[model samples]
Target: MNQQYTIAGLDLPDINPEDKLNRILSSALEKTNGYLINKSTSLAHYWDANYFNLDKVQIFQDSTPAEQSSILQLCNLGILEEAYFIEKAGMGYMAKMILLAETISERMLYGLFAADEVTHFSQISSFLPTPKVSYNPFLDLLENVVESEDKTVLLFVLQVVLEGWGLTHYRSIASCCQNPHLKSILQGFLQDESRHHATGVTLLENRSLGKSSQNIVEILAMFLQMVQLGPQSVVKAVEQVKGHLSKQDKINIFAQLDTETHSGSRLKLLRNLIDLPNAKNILENLEMKGSFQPLKPSQCVSFNCS
Candidate 1:
């Protein structure tokens, strides 16, 4: 039997061979995970290494095939690691929301959401080379908001805005993913995410930001800043495989990324997400500040994320 690392968790534990109670609990846990896997739409949710389309990525344009392959793998690993942590972060926020649920119905919705997040975490973790739980800017921001003791603000920002954005984010990944099985999971997960997002829309539809407007704008601005950090992933992936790049190299790579198109599409989708009726004034203010504009690769290339 595999040794148990955690004394308490939803994971099936190593049972005492002779302990009937332990065996029963282990059996139940095994079945639970089995159900969750099926609920995720398939049991063969493995990572697919199908060739990544780099035609638009530009960095791979002049690279040798082997170099391109290396960068692709690194990029995939980074994306999966980030997804793993982000989904884990989803579980964290869902659990917190369950505790913060003001009504039985709200509690039920969050309970279901928590289960969905755990399933996503399990599936994404299978794609990782090794387990990692590192800091993520979005995750950190999410954790802070959960601790902020305002349910309405939480709903508007997390569910209404972020999860609303996730519909497009997850759908885009699913559409382009080569792995049929993982694509199915992403598709299924999006359905749940859609419902989770709807919960916020239904709950806060007409609720004014009121006293929370300033805090809401500040939190949202941080998210916009993250949006402005474009092509960083591609640049870093290239550097990892090709070593230190000159500024010109970075700028050239950024140009190849078709950053204008990426930035425009992303900013447009983001604007639509937060354009709620109750947030009319906030939306106008954000638009005025160009908070919804995507970053220009040349300008962003010089901005050091480190």
Candidate 2:
């Protein structure tokens, strides 16, 4: 009999040797967290009409000039820091794909959100003042993951691990902005991400993950190693800003995010997906590993508009 990994705070039944597909599908479902956002009919139109038009957006239309300037600074960073935006948007779809490997839930909605990312990229790209500067690095991460053998591991790497780092990035950028409009925009973009991560957690924990899916644990380990050293933006941030912030500062910032951000909500979904004790051990280990190195303006941008 194959050894089974305990998950969801329960001992998994012994692997059914005769049915391998059932075991794999069950493990995949166990990892999934159910939908949090309701799919309203106008949701798609709401996103497109609101965020796509730079002309229509007046940064904090209700705020003073001081607030507007701060928002512009953030927009500048978002424009300059386009890499993170690109990656986060792409990671939204990638996470869905990984979650897909784990469950049969929300199959149609998963495809919709994936399509949403692509449409979003197009929308965001159209509004860029200089849209010609290609972000090749973002594409490369997608290519590598899509080419990998196991969709399950790739999802955790990109969605949970990589997006976990990105949640911090979004909060920082949003906080720096004093303008309500820009902050609202950032928040709007992030809501989709929040849902995507939730899907990953749901997929990870569905009751189907039984004894035969021990490969998932090792796959998760491999994902952590890659996230710690992948070609993705978080790793890029680390490589660029490895020495800029003090160690304590980085730890404090990550911890602050743990407490303050909606990210903690996603962690709860993860806790629900995995067995309670195992989830605690794994998450605590990840937290102790500390956050990624910060990204500096000098490293992330190549063009200057003076």
Candidate 3:
């Protein structure tokens, strides 16, 4: 069956941001969603409702003074980049839906997914303390994938691979975060990402790879490498913010960072992706060509490099 499944009658929740945003935010974070109730509230109040109160987060409760400072810097960098990537991906998905979706239902689903991404971006951006700017490696990689002319490959990359990685990463962060507000937001994102990943898997399973399997595999390799390398700009930004820290304090902060751990997780996700029933043939072809190799960490140029 070329069309593996249809989500036409899927009983997915109709997310009305106005009515449901507060409920979703409050429930996930275990906090009251009362920030938006008063029309006269300042932007900071709205942001504060979703932002983490460092004193309240469990991870930093027992840390030393230097460690607490480092964590705050890291959180700032993480939050800004998270917002940036969500916005970038949301825009890309909207564009792809308009250009490539073959059915009305598919288009509708993508539209809703895009809307959710924007909502996430907006809420996260609101929480920033200052205007922060940094380069995002993963977002750059996603742009490359979106530019490809092959819609199937695009779907596989964004929905299946990237979103799958996102689901895992978000869950990991949310579980460790002591702040209920951020945890709630991450949960909301996970819900949408799960749906997107499932749909991508089904769509890819039903489609024939034909001659494009090799291309798809190569794209997957590039994505894995990007993950392993981590984001240079974000690292640099964090370093700049923590420039005053002593040498040992710097070491402590880096130790707490999860760059290597995330790389390993992403690599595992890639392996599982190609091990799926429908992906067996593609995997065999790559293995025969001796192209299946583990990526090592290195400082690489932007993802747009050939």
> lDDT of all predictions, in order shown?
0.70, 0.41, 0.55
lDDT of 3 by residue, 57-168 (tens): 3335565676656655565546545654555456556656665788888888877766666566555544454333344455555655666678777767677777787788
> Please, what are the lDDT tens digits per residue for candidate 1 over residues 194-285?
99999999888767789887778888888877777665776787888888988888877777776666667777788888888888877887
The backbone clash count of each candidate, in order, is 0, 23, 1
Model 1 residue pairs with clashes:
none
Please estimate how well model 1 matches the true structure, expressed as its whole-model Cα lDDT: 0.70
lDDT of 2 by residue, 181-247 (tens): 4465565557776776666555555434343234445444433333332112321233233335444
Q: Tell me the spans in candidate 1 whose CA falls farther than 4 Å from its real position.
A: 1-53, 57-59
Among the numbered candidates, top TM-score falls to 1
| Model 2: residues with Cα > 4 Å off, grouped in runs | 1-104, 131-143, 178-180, 206-306
Candidate 1 residue 207 C-alpha distance from true site, Å: 2.2
